[model samples]
Target: MAETRVKSFVLRFLLAQPLTYWKLLKYIDVDIPTVQKTLKNLLRNKILEYKNNLFYLTSKGREEAKDLGISVFNSAMCPECHGKTVTLSPFKWLVKEFESLTFERPKAISEYDQGYVDSTDTVARVIFMYQLGDIEGKNIILLGDDDLTSLALLASGFPKQVTVLEIDQRILNFIEKKAALKGWNNLEVIRYDVREPLPDQFKGKYDVFLTDPVETIGGLRLFLSRCVEALKGEGSIGYFGLTHLEASRQKWWNIQKDILEMGFTITDIVRGFHTYLLERDDILNLELKVVKEAPVEIKIPEVDFYTSNLFRIYAVNSPQPLVRGKVDWQRELYYDQEAYVTCP
Candidate 1:
């Protein structure tokens, strides 16, 4: 997909500039024959029309670009975080627009946009409910107002009644106006601090509940436990955590463990970043950065069963030798174990 995009970009420019053989071949990373082959393919497919030595994108190609362009969205430089890159999904776009439209005035939301708090991903909000299958007419609650996850659900023509429980009235008022403007019959906004136990009226009445708690705080357990408390026997709860450089996958597992212990089934999984649509390639094995700083005389630490109750690797220079001449610890200790997985 990326290659095709790069080729499309190069073609658009070449068509505009009518790059000479030398310049076309010299300026772009792709070779002359390769660029010519792409140009020929585009000409054959009627995506680009060649007349004389000049090439131009055809009406069909222009139309297609326009259609694809509908999915593109822009942000105002993220005024706070200064993170420039953003994902290109339309659903993700609407979630962002919906949230900004819904919470443009709150002090907390202002803080969030300023990066005083953390930014949340809208795609993740939808996906959590989406991965669980249908929610039409299902009772739902969202603790935070980032992108109005529940509001998006209402607009999707599903979720019978969405009860958004938020602390900020300015945010709530914004959502209420949005619901009224859209004529959404099933959406409701409530003012409540989710940190407290769920109100008596909400207990066992919800079908789906989720939280994107105050970022970086340890309030996840409390919020999740409240969601669990408000859920019916078969209800589901989803929550998100902000994991920066301090945590690893093992720590995420610990988070999952804690959630499971709170009495909700922890089966489905989703991962995302604030502004960027994350990919597997983003995870770098940064162990070398730490290892490069240690003293020369220092020895790699051994796995202490209790102390290293997380992922473990025995020191290569341990005091004791293996029981036999050698032992395959990788296979014996954690083959196929997810907790100890290396990057693929």
Candidate 2:
């Protein structure tokens, strides 16, 4: 059943033009392993062909697409906003400063599953939080700082305090050095892992929390449980990113159920709200199934095709954490069968 749906989606999308593996991953709403398997099946069946580092329909595939009634349509996104519904025009100055400050930022490493959104998207996230009254004078905590959202929040001159809890020593040192150079006394970086219990000082101390959690069910639960433990109480807010490339609809349903169980009422979910700028070098270094199994040698992607939906949830009641004191979940926390991009 899942294979049928993925085949239909791939055939319809390829009806318009040839696409690279990265573009297919961006457009398809299935898990990475599923997409890779489906593509291999299609090629074996002579329904698709690979050439010039792109995948397109074969003659038989076009006949199948016609039988499936697939038709091309124009995109309906706002050109100015790129479908984000918000722009950085209001904070152009901050965008320039953020660019300079992050010019020498550390490159993303696949070991920690680290990738960051574009500079505009980073500031746009800050703008969105500010509009929601979650920025100015709010005590906010970021479970991880690979995106350097902490810097954007501090640069906005909002937020009474911003704290970062990260496992990567490189990220911790980078953020701390930046904070000191800018004299951002309100910023704090803590070298902490998520598998452990939430620190006593941070529990119930923040008005808002943000994290881009790993997409596995266990990963999501652990990350959000920590965020829940950090909130001040009812009315506190949290933000995070979820992507279809890694998580399927069934997984999304389970995640939504977990959020409700944790006493969070989802306020808004903006689809494709964040676009990640994955470095080419970083991607080439990883062991991606799609690249390894492609019929033709896949070229490194030139476009920023990876994206995620941004979700905002409010703590309507006292937050309940599913995992209080963590048991050992080393590889399970980061890797699962659905995890195609993450290294084991």
Candidate 3:
């Protein structure tokens, strides 16, 4: 049943244009292994062909797409906002400053499953938070700081306090050094592993929480649970990024269910709102399984295609976390069947 849906999706997507593995992976809502298997089956049946590092439907595939009621058409999004549903024009200076400040920042390491959105996206996030009245004079807590969103928030000088809880020592050091250099008295950086108990000092101590969590059931629950622990009470807000590339519809349903159980009501979700910046070197070094097991040798990606939807949820009542105390998830926290990009 799932395989049939993936096949139909791939066929219809190809009707738009030929796409590379990276592009297909970015747009597909299924798991990596399933996608790879579908591609193999399509090729075996001569419904798809690989050429010049791009995959497109064959003659039979086109007929199959016609049978599936697929049509060729072009869809356009707001070019100015790039479908983020927010404009970055107002935050141009902030984006420039953020780019300079983070130019020499630490590189993303796979050990912590770390990656960050583009500098413009970072500032755009701040703009969105500000528009929502969650920024000015509000206590903000970031469950993870790989994106260095704390820096952008501090640069804006809107938040009363910004606290970063990260397990990465390098990130902690980088944020701490910059905060001291700029004399950001209200900014705090703490070395925290999410598996540990929520620190008493941080519990119920924030007005807003932000995180780009690992996209596994256990990881999502753990990350959001910790964020929920930080919120002061009802009306406190939370923002996080979720990706279709890593999470399927079923997984999304599970996550939404978990969020409701935590006493938070999801207010908004902007698809493709966050885009990660990955250099050629970053991709080559990450050792992704899709690249390793490609039917054809995958070329270096020419664009930043990895993206996620930004979710904004607010506590309707006193938030109730699903997990508490010290519980180690070990490999389960970082790698799952759907985690194709994560190194196993």
lDDT of each: 0.46, 0.86, 0.87
Relative to the unseen true structure, what is the Cα RMSD of model 1? 19.2
lDDT of 2 by residue, 265-311 (tens): 99999888889887776666677654565545778887777789999
How well is each residue in 1-344 modelled by candidate 1, as lDDT tens digits? 32364355545554455433223322333322344455556667787665554455667766655655522223244553233123324455555655564455344322221111222444434544454553666787777664456666766666778888877777788778878988887877889765454677876776666665432213444555555665665434444443322233444566566554555455433322333211212112322221222212212322110001111111122111111122222222211222111121
Taking all chains together, the TM-score of candidate 2 against the true structure is 0.93
Candidate 3 C-alpha lDDT tens digits along 260-329: 9999999999888888875556566677775676656888887676788999999999999999999967
TM match of model 1 to true structure: 0.47
Q: After superposition, how far is residue 237 of candidate 1 from its true place, in Å?
A: 4.1
Clashing pairs in 1: 137-160
Which ranges in model 1 have alpha carbons more than 4 Å from their true place? 1-124, 215-217, 235-242, 246-253, 273-344
Q: Of 1 and 2, which scores higher on lDDT?
A: 2
Report the number of clashing residue pairs per model. Answer: 1, 0, 0
CA error at residue 207 for candidate 1, angstroms:
1.4
Per-prediction CA RMSD (Å): 19.2, 1.9, 1.9
Residue 207, model 3: lDDT of 96
RMSD (CA, Å), candidate 2 to true, equals: 1.9
Error of 2 at 98 (Å): 1.1
